[model samples]
Structure formats: structure tokens, C-alpha cells
Target chain A: MPGTRGRRADARRNATAILDAAVECLSRDPDASVADIAQAAGVGRVTLYGHFASREELLDAVFARAMREADAALDSLDLEGDPRQAMVLLIRSSWRIVDRSRALLVAAERGLPHGRIRELHQRPLHRIERLIERGREQGEFRTDMPVAWLSAAFYGVLHTTADEITAGRLDEADAPGALTGILLAAFTPPGQPVPTAD
Target chain B: MPGTRGRRADARRNATAILDAAVECLSRDPDASVADIAQAAGVGRVTLYGHFASREELLDAVFARAMREADAALDSLDLEGDPRQAMVLLIRSSWRIVDRSRALLVAAERGLPHGRIRELHQRPLHRIERLIERGREQGEFRTDMPVAWLSAAFYGVLHTTADEITAGRLDEADAPGALTGILLAAFTPPGQPVPTAD
Candidate 1:
């Protein structure tokens, strides 16, 4: 039992290495094989199997890693700017993450069950909700709407922008600016009341 | 050559029938097959091939049909209500199109070359642009921002909402009302000048 525990620990380490290597290789080449990932991780076939029983498991691990990385990015982001600016930053950051992990995203899209990735999205939604409340209090955003609706719109903008960029209809350089403009136009408060020149 | 040309005309009819059947069938069942489509359309194997030559070709035709249907919806849509109401209608109508042709959409997402379907989107963009101009001219919408940005945001909300409904995250019935509130909140003018409560 003592020796078995030690082997399990070693096996876990090898699995992590293989998963990291798979994430890297898959990001570069979606069709990268398990052998290539094992080679990249400097692990033997037996070691790789000791960790992941099959290629599908290895790919799933890589996808989970990418999701965790994206989650960490969201968690560590500083959203201290004006509410509108903060929203823009969040969307842009999300696009960057999606772009960086496009291959894995495509794999997740095709292979994983629908809505699995979305379960990891609640934290980002809560953060954005706070920013929306602050913007409303600051008189910069509309106060009459529900936070859930705003959250949906925020997500909509992010997902649609990512799709546009992925489809090559939207230029990557212009995505952030364009999306910012859209969000601002939607959320910005009304200006000075101009009396009608009758 | 004359005989061949006559045969080709009949082939074109059969191909169109096959594509229509495929779109209808696929809209209901994404896994629908070539044989199913051919049977539904009452087309013989030889006739189906004389037009499509492959399942991918039939899929391409179906995607093209869906895009064309979307454009037709835009063209025929009455933009007569309050600008906000008109915009809401536009979103709802677009969502309905996607819902009705979800099978075709799934095929388009998987099989059609990316960006091809979006090209059919420009007509709706222009319509929304004109509507935004009307709202601004009526002093209901913001004048400082570009209409293009507003147009894109409108599409973004619709696309995102449709996707959520497809993925079963957002309730299908809630999409219209929720999106309308978000769009209106985002676009509505800020505070009217009044004495400060504080």
C-alpha cells in the first residue's frame, strides 16, 4: 500500500505533464497525436497510459486545463475602471483567451457535451453584475433593467464578437475597439438636455 | 447537346427538391441522411446525383437556402413601429428564423465554409442602421455614436440570445422580452436634468 501510493503520486505527475504538453501541441496542431504529446512531455508510452488510459482522456484533460486557465484569467483580472471600460476589458480579455485557445475551443465545441464550459461562467457573470451595479449607481448605466438581462447581453456581445473574429469577418485588431464602441453606445448615459429649437 | 440540356433542366428541378427536403428534414433531425432526403423528395438516386453529386453539396444548398430565407425576412419586414419596438421585432424575427431552420443552421455551422452565411447578414445590418438613424433623428436614440456600432450590437444580442436558446441556457420564451429590455436599456438616453436629491 505504501509503494502503491507513491506510484499513484508519480503517475499523477506524469499525467499532468502529458496534459500540459497536449494543450501546447493541440493549440498548435489540433490533430496532434498522443504519442507526440508524450514525446513532447518526455514521458514514455507506459507512463502516459499510467496517467491517461486513452487519447480521449488526454484531450479532455487538455480542455479542462484550458478552461481552468481561462477561469484564472477572469479571476485575476482587475476591473477597477469606469463600468463601461471594465466591461470592454472583460470582453477583450475573453476574446483573447478564445483566440489563444481556438483549437481547443473547436475540439470542445465538437467533442464535449453542450453547456459544460458554460457551467464555469458563473463567476465572470457575477463580477460583471457588480460592475453594472456600480455603473448604475454612478449614473452611467441604466438602472431599470435586471442584472441578469445585462449579463446576457454582455455574454452575447462577447460570444458574437468571438464568432466574428473566428469567422474572419471581423479583424482581430478591430475587435476590441469595435466591441467597446458597441458596449459603450448601449450603456452610456444620456448627455445634457437640449431644449428644442422650435 | 439539346437532349443533354433538357435532361439538365430536369436534374436542376430534382436537385432543388432534394435540397429543400434535406433542409426540412435536417431542421427536424440534424442526423437526417441523403437517402432520407432523396426519399422525401421522391427523387431517384441518379436524379439526386445529377444535381448535388454529394451530401456536402446538398448541405451547401440547404445553408444557402436558409441564408436566402433570412434575407427575405429582412427585406419583407415592416419597420413601422416605434424604433425600439421595430428593433425588438427584428431581433425576434431573426431568432424565429434560426429556430425554424435550426437543422440547416447546425449543418451550416458544421459543413459550410465559415463566413459565407454572415455575408447574407449585411442587408439586415443596413436596415437596422437606417432604423437607428430614425431613432436618433426623433431624439430617442443617442446621436454621438456610429450607427454601425449600434447595428452590430443589435445583431450581437440576437445571435447570442438565439445561441442561448439553442443551448437551453435561456428559456426560449424569455429571449424576446429579455433582449428587448437589454437593448432598450443600453440605448435609452440617460437622466433628464432635475434638481439633485442630495
Candidate 2:
């Protein structure tokens, strides 16, 4: 029993190391091969294959890992607060996770099949949809647009803002606050005066 | 002299046909070949080569044509009105132009050199920059963020909104109005209450 437990721990450790290494490698080069990933992970090709049958499988694992991290980040936002404040928290938290997962997301978009990619986004999308619905119900967000379109726009702006940060057009330090302000302003009920200086 | 004039007319017609076909072919498939474009244009390979010596030259012509069309579309917008109302007209007119040139833009991103692509965008970017500056001068926009970043964000949101429209996530009819409202709201001077419900 003791031997079995020790072996299980070893396997788990190895898998974690490989996943981390794969994320790093693939983020740097989406076209990286299994041999490259194995070298980065300090594991042999055979050992890498033992854990993931193919490069596709390894990429899937990396994408899954990134999704889990993103979801975990979202979960930590204490989403039950005031809808406006909760949204601010959500934006700040999600942006950090996006910054960390940038390379993984790029790699997945390039290498993963569309269906798999959509599946990976499904959970996050649902969580965001629910949040938007809550905001609408609470009268924090305007009811003019459907929750679906607003959710889509939310993602769209986040991505564009990230691109700006990456290009040095926008300061990373200021992005979260700026994004929160822009999003809230855009969603304010039509005819409501613009937000006053806080 | 008559013979020369007749030949010039024929040459001009052929050039127009070739350029139009190139736009259509490249938009449909960025990887399309010169031969494919020539066939679509109903011009012999020899004649196509006679007008443009290389594929690169042909692509440059297609990009130039698309830019001109976009510029013309912008020209139609009455930008002399209230800055905020002017922005709405600009968004609506520019979006229609973007919708038309969507294919060309995608192809150019894939096929054109980065420097050349940036050059193509320079004019339109300047136009947008000027519009933003005018808004600030009129005190319709916030003075806190740099005009440059706001311009970048403007393009980013426009592109994302375009994507949503293409995917049927946003209705074409609703896009211009939504985009204008969103942009105005975001740029409204800080500390102002949200716009009254119109």
C-alpha cells in the first residue's frame, strides 16, 4: 500500500511538471514539437509520450490547464458583492488571468480544433453570462441589449485592451481601472448622464 | 493617332477588370494565385502580366483600391456637425465600408508586409485621431487618457464589433447605433453623470 501511494505521488508530480513546461514552451512557440516540450520539461521523449500520447493530446492538456486556471481566478472574485463592484473585481481578476494565459490561448487558437476550443470556452462563457444576467436583474446594467451580446462585447474589449497593453499603447498598471470605467460607461442606461469623476 | 487612342481604351478596360477580379478572388481566398485571378478576370495570363509584372504588384494594387474605397466612404460622412453626432456618422459610414472591405483586409494581413500594412492604415488612423482630438477640443471627450490610446481602442472595438456582426452575434442593423452609443459613453468627460435616458 505504501509503495502504491508513493508511485501515485511521483506520477502526479511528473504530470504537473510536464504541463507547466508545455505551457511555457507552447506559449513561446505554438509550433513547438513534443521533443522540444520533453526537453524543456527535463523528461525523455518516451516519458512524455507515456503521459500524453501525441502532441495534439499535450496541447489539449495545456489548454485544459489554462482554462482551469482562468476559472479558478474567476471563482476567487467574490462575485456575490454589489453588481458594479463585483464586475470591477471580475474585470481586474480576469485580466490578470488573461495576461498569464496569453501564450496558452494563442497556442490553443492556432493548434486546437474549433470544437475543442469552443468546449474549453464554454464554462467561462456561462459564468460571464450568468454574471451579466445578475447585473441586469439588479438594474446595474442597461436592459437595452441582450445579455448575450454584452457578454460578447465584454470579451471583445478585453482582448483588444490586452493587445494595446502588449503593444505598449496602454499601460498595464492602468488597464484594469480603465477597462472597468469604459465598460460601465458603455453599459450605462441610455440617456443617463456620463459617470461623474469618482 | 486613332489607333493609339483605341488601344489605350482597351488597355484601361482590361486593367479595371483585372483589379476588380483580384479583389474578389483574394477576398474569397487569400492564398489565391495570379493565374486564378487572371482566369476570373477573363484576361489571358500574358495580358495580366503585361499590366502587373508580379503577384506582389497585383496585391498592392488590390490593397490600394480597397483603401481608396474606404476613404471615399469616410468622405461621405458629414464630420462638421457636433463632435458627438459626427462620431456617430463616422462609425456608421465607416462600418459599411469596413463590411465591404472585410475580405481585402483579412487577405492583406496575411499577405502584406507589416510595414506596408501599417502604411495603408496611416491615413485612416490619422483621420480617426483628428476626430478624437476635435472632440477633446470641444470638451466632449475626456482629457485624461492620451488621444493615441483612445484611437487604438476605437479601432479595436470597431474590429471586434465587426467580428460579432459577421458571426451573427450582433445584428448588422443595430451595430452602427450600438457602436456609436458605446463610444460616446466611454469618451464622455469623467465625473459627468451617465447620459439621461433618451
Candidate 3:
């Protein structure tokens, strides 16, 4: 029984490795093949197949894992401080996910049901919306634009930054500050002073 | 011959009216009916069908006409003065097209090949790119990010604003100033004094 449990642990570790590698490979190229992901994970094709039956299965696992991690990561951030500082913290943490997961998102979009994607987006969007609401209430953010629009625009900035990176137009290094600065200015009521990215 | 010329002018006027009304109705709602468009145009339903044989045909024509009008409108703007002022002028003109074409764009994306969409974007994107380049040289825009990134980000802002409007999260009246403030802040060479929206 001990030996059996040890083997189960190994299987779990292998499956996780495969999913992580798939995120890396697929995010770099949506066209990345099963063999490519397997190699990146340092597992043989047989080992990968032992875990996931097919490429769709692997992609689904990768997509779900990425979102779950993003959800948990974003949810865990201490968003209770000064609203602007909270936003800065949120942007810093969020950019890492955007940078790593954009390519994988491209892959998932190819084969997944759009309804599933939208469903997954709800929790994360609401989380950001609540933050904006707090900011708006405290007068730390603009009241002129709808809180949801500011949140939606923040998402837009992330995605646009991702596209700009893929197109070789934006450097990854600049994304966090760029996102923060843009959102801060956009969220500030027109006549109010815009905050600079620290 | 004079009578024939008069008939030709009437036909052209009818076609233009239908196209204009199609833009208005479709932008307000993508599911707008042909009857709705014809009525909005103040033309008979038969006249609308005579100009556009089918809904698909009318949508195609609307998309093309909107792009042409946008291209002409943007090209006619003088972009030679202060870089910030030029960008402000560009955003003002571009928002009109965005405000008009966004919902229609949703319909077109549903039925048209994407290559055509990318093709139409090129000229406008390049024009913005050139303006950003000028801004960078004059220290009016950040050189840290790519000129192309700023251009793409501007487009993202427009689309996001349109979506926000549709979702009832943004007001149309707030968009032009919102677009200008965000871009001016985002594009200003970071660490420099950010310009207030005029």
C-alpha cells in the first residue's frame, strides 16, 4: 500500500509537470504539439499519454489550471490598503499571469466553448469591479465613468498589452507600469489629477 | 437625357440614405431589422432591398462605407502641430467612427472573413503609428514603448469604450474625453509631467 501511494504521488507530480509545461509551450505558440509539451515537461510521450488522453484533453487541463491559479492568485492579494496602492499591487500580480498565459489563452480560445470562457471570466471581473467600486466610493478613483467600465478597461489594457507584446510592439517590462498609468489616468475624473506609477 | 440624369441622382441619394441609416440603426443595435433600417432611412422597404439585395449585402456595404468615411475623416485632420494636440484631434475624429461602427462591426465579424478586417485596419494603424513616431522624436510621447503599441492600445480603447457603451457601463458623451485623457497619460514619456485633457 505504501508503494502504491508513492506511485500515486509520482503520477500527480507528472500530471502537474505536464500541465505547467503545456502552459509554457502553448503560450509561446498555440500551435505547439504534444511532443513539444512533453519534451518541455521532461516526460516521454508515453508518460504524457498516461495522464492526458489527447491534445484537447491536455489543452483543457492547461486552460483550467491557468485560470484557477489566476483566480486564486488575484483573490489572495491584500486589496484592503490605500486604493491606488491596492491597484498597483493588483496590476503587478496580474501582469505575471497575463505574460505567461496569453499564448495559452490563444490556444484555449481555438477549441474551448466560448460559454465556458465567459463563465470563467465572471469571478475575476467581479473581483476587479468591487475594487473599482471601493476606489470610486473613497474618491480615490473617478466617479464619472462607471465602475464596471473602469474594470473592463483594465482588462482591455491587459489584453492590449498582451497583443502588443505578441506583435513585438510592447516590451513585457513596461506592461505593469503602462497598465497602471493608463488605468489610473483613465479612471481619474477628467479634471482631477492623474496618479503617476511608482 | 436630362430626365435620365435626374433619375440617377435620385437613386444615388436613396442609396446614400439607406447606408447612413443602416449605420445609425446597426450601431445602436446589431440585431436591427432591415425594416427598421428602411424606416430609419425614410425610404420604402422595396428601395432598401433594391439597393442591397440581402441583409449580408447591406452589412458589407455599411462596413465598407464606414471604413472609407473613417479613413477620409482621419486623413483630412491636420497632424502637424503639437504632438499632444494632434493626438487629441486624432482621437476626436476616430471616436465618431467607433461610436458609429462598433455594433455593425459585431455583425460584420459574425459573417465576414477576418482578413478583410485586418486589411482595413492597416492604413489607419500606420497613420497613427507615424504620428506616435513624431511624438516620440519630439519627447511628446514615450519612446520606451513601441509606436505600434500606442496605436494598437488606442484601438483597444475605442473598442472597449464601444463595448462598455453597449453593456450600459459607459456613456457615449464621456468617451472622447476619456479616450484623450487615457492616451495622453499613457503615451506621455513616463516620469515626465502628464498632460491634462483639454
Candidate 4:
């Protein structure tokens, strides 16, 4: 029983290591080879293959892991205070998570099923949608646009920031502040004064 | 000499009509045939062929024409007032022109030279860049991000608004307001009060 339990624990550790390494390598270079990933993980290719079965499976695992981490970060934010501030916190965290995940997404998109990828993408939107609904109720965010449209608009801006950054027009260091500045003001209900002018 | 000049004028008018028709037809349907454009222009296929040797040439003409119109509309805006208000005016007009041209852009991207398209695109950005400079100097827009980056971010959001509408996520009527709000809020200098609180 001791030997059997130890083997299971070792298997879990190796699988986690492979996933972490896969994301790191694949994110940097979507075309990264399995051998490169296995080496990055410090595991033999055979051991990596033993767990993944194929690149497709490995991509699925990596996508799931990336989404899980993004969700965990989002979930950890204290969305309890001023909804605008809460949303700023939520989005800043989401930006960081999604920025890292975005590179891996290019790799995952080619190998993973489209439906699964879409479903994972919606979770974060739903999270934003709920916050929008809460903010509208609390009289923080604008209600003139539908909660759905506002959320979609916010999401669109969020992704576009990444595109602009990639195009070398936006500096990475300025992204979070720029994003908060843009979104926080937009979220204010139309005709409502923006909070706390200094 | 009079006869020859009259003939040349007639030919110029025909070319203009054909370009107008091509933009109207292609903007609605990118695959609109040469015959369709000729008919829309109140000219015959023979005249159309005489004017444009091939579809590629026709597309090039159509693209050049669209940029010309977009530029003219952008030029007409009274950008002499408040810098933020001037930008909003500039953007609202640009949005209408670009929204119409966006469809033509798809067809042009294939047949037109990339450099030509790039050159045409920069004209509007130059218009925006001048406005951003005025805004920053006037203490209206933020100075933390570079002028180029601010202009790029505004351009990105402007384009994203068109995308959301096409995707059915944003209503067309609500677009200008939503876009103006997002951009206006974002454009304000950090720590400054937004103009006109309700």
C-alpha cells in the first residue's frame, strides 16, 4: 500500500510538472516541440507521452490548466466594495491571467476543439456580466447599454489592448493603468459624475 | 478642342459614377460582379470594362475612392473647439465613413497594394494625432501614455466598436454614444474632473 500510494503521488507530481512546462514552452513558442517541452519539464519524453497520449490531449490539459489559474485569480479578488473599484480589480487580475494565457491560446486553438475553447472563454465573460449586473443595481456602472452589450464592449477593449501591445503601440507596463482608466470611466452611468475628482 | 474637352469630362464623370457604384455594391456584397456595378452606376459593362481593365484595377479604384470620401468627411469636421469635444466630433464622423468603408476594406485588402492601403490609413491617424496633441497641451487628455499610443488606443476602440456591432453585440444606434463615453472618459487627463456632470 505504501509503495502504491507513493507511485500515485509521483505520477501526480510528474503530470503537474509536464502541464506547467507545456504552458511555459508552448506559450513562448506555439510551435514548440514535444521534446522541448519534455526537457523543459525535466521529465523524459516517454513519461510525458505516457500521461498525454498525444499533443492534442496535452493542449487540452494546458488549456484547462490556464483557464483554471485565470479563474482562480479572478475568484480571489474582493468584488465587495465600490463596484467600479471592484471591477477594476477584477479586470486587472483578468488582464494579467489572460495575457499569459493568450500565447498558449494560439497553440491550443489549433489543437483543441472549438466548442471547448469557446465554453472556457465564456466563463470569464459571465464573471464580468455578473459584476456589471451588480454594478448597475448598485448605481455604479452605466445601465443605458444592456448589461450584455457593456460586458461585450468591455471584453472587446480588453482583448484589443493585447492586440495593440502586440503591435508595439502600447507599452506592457502601462497596460493595467490604461485599461483601468479607460474602463472605469466608461462604466460610469451616463450623465453620472465620475467618482472622486482630485 | 471643345468637343475633345467635353468627351474627357464625360469620361471622368463615368469613372466617378462607376467608383461610387462599386463602393455601394461591394460594401453591401464583396462578391458583387462587374456587371452589377456597371448597372448600379447607370452605365454598361462595355463602358465599365473600358474604364477598368480588370476586377483588380476596379478594386483599386474603389479603394482609392473610398479613402478619398472618408478623408473628405473627416476634413469637414469643425475641430476648432474643446479638444475633447473636437475629438468626439472627429471620431463620430470618422466612424460613419469607416463603417461604410469597412466592407470595402475587405475586398481592397486582397487586390490593392498593402503599402497603398497603409498610406491611406495613416491620413486619418494623422488627423487624430493632431487632436491628441491639442488635448494633451490643453490639459484635457492624459500625458502618461505617449501621443501615438493614445491615438492608437482610441483608434483601436473605435474599430472595436464597429466589430461589436457587426457581431450583433452592440446596437448601431448606441455605438456612437458608447464609444464616445468610453473614449471620452479614457481621454481625460488623470485626476481631472470629467466635463459636465449631471
Best by TM-score: 2
Clashing pairs for model 1 are A186-B186, A190-B190
DockQ values of all predictions = 0.21, 0.37, 0.26, 0.20
Identify the runs in model 4 with alpha carbons over 4 angstroms from their true place: A1-73, A102-120, A190-198, B1-26, B29-68, B102-120, B195-198
What is candidate 3's lDDT per residue for A1-198, written digit by digit as tens? 559889999999999999989878886788799999999999999999999999988887887777888999899899997888888888778778878777776676555543355456667778888888898889777665556666767777777788667656677787877777766666665455556655
**Cα lDDT computed for each candidate against the true fold:** 0.68, 0.74, 0.77, 0.74
Q: Give a tens-digit lDDT track for model 4, residues B1-198.
A: 559889999999999999989989988887788999999999999999999999878998788767777888888888988997797788788777767666675566445553455456677878888998888898887766556655666666665566556556667887777667667776776556554321
Interface RMSD over true interface Cα atoms for each candidate = 8.0, 3.9, 4.0, 5.5
lDDT (0-100) at residue B113 of candidate 2? 51
**Highest lDDT among the candidates is held by which one?**
3
Clashes of 1: 2
Model 3 residue B48 CA deviation in Å: 18
**Per-residue lDDT of model 1, residues B1-198, tens digit only:** 559889888877777788778877887777687888889999877777767878877787777766777888777988886886776677677767766665566666555543455565677778878988888787676554446655766776776565566766667776666656556544554342211111
> Model 3 clash pairs?
A27-A104
Q: How close is every model to the real structure, measured as TM-score? A: 0.69, 0.76, 0.66, 0.65
**Candidate 2: tens digits of C-alpha lDDT, residues B1-198:** 559889999999999999999998987887689999999999999999999998878898889878877887686667886987777777777777776666676566455653465466667767878888898899887776666666766766776566556556677777666777677777888766555322
Scored by TM against the true chain B, the candidates give 0.77, 0.82, 0.74, 0.79
lDDT of 4 by residue, A11-121 (tens): 999999999899889978876888999999999999999999988888888888778778777777788878877887887888887666666755764456534664566
Better of 1 and 2 by lDDT: 2
Sort by lDDT, best first: what order? Answer: 3, 2, 4, 1
